[model samples]
Target: MRPDPHVDTVDHPHADDLHGDDPHGDDPRTGSAGHVRVDTAALGRVAAAVTAAAVQAGDAASAVPGLIPPPRWASAYSAERAAEAAGHRMRELSADLSGTSASISTTVLEYEDADARTSTRFRAAR
Candidate 1:
């Protein structure tokens, strides 16, 4: 039988504590069994990049309609409609990107606030 790759076999310090096997029935690092760590700096950078892409998408949306020339024949009407639809889709994408950027920013702010509150509590306890 192949050894389970997902399971760690090597013994290490605090391994049992991390796995919720502590004798005291609580994690030593925190009061909980699991922990979450977020890199706000990286999230901020990603939010900035997303915001930039949204701006570019908005610019493209604005330019798309004009790039397609006026319909000169009956058959061209469908092409014009298609171009308009493409532009509309681009606008939707830009809106979605903007929303995503805002969400990321909000998440970073929430994480930072939680960290600050945790630090304050720890300091007060100390």
Candidate 2:
């Protein structure tokens, strides 16, 4: 029989493994239902895009200010410097967020790949 694409083919929990709290105990792979749900691979792709945009925006924010015409007043220049400092801080924050999102995306994709491989092996064994 051809495998159903919607079904998660991981090893199902045996009757002995079922507990009162675990209602979908028959399918351990799904942890809820027999179906494969929650597309984390798509989420990872979105996260990657967000990370890239954030980093790019941060870089632009850091660089674009230098091109701004300086204020004629000395006091205004100090304010501009302060604003520039804030921009630097924002760049750092964006970089951190990018790193975190990239890490999350990588982890999610890796998990999905591993889960698919394990499920495939389990089905083959059965």
In model 2, state the lDDT of residue 51.
Answer: 88
> Candidate 1: misplaced stretches above 4 Å?
1-33, 65-74
**Residue by residue across 1-126, what tens digits does model 1's lDDT show?**
233455422212345756666666445463344343355777888999999999999999998636456558976888777888999999999999999999999988877776777678879999
Q: Could you report the Cα RMSD, in angstroms, for every candidate shown?
A: 9.4, 5.9
**Model 2 TM-score on a 0 to 1 scale:** 0.56
List TM-scores for all candidates, in order: 0.69, 0.56
lDDT of each: 0.73, 0.66
Clashing pairs in model 1, backbone N/Cα/C closer than 3 A: none
Candidate 2 global lDDT: 0.66
Candidate 2 backbone overlaps, count: 0
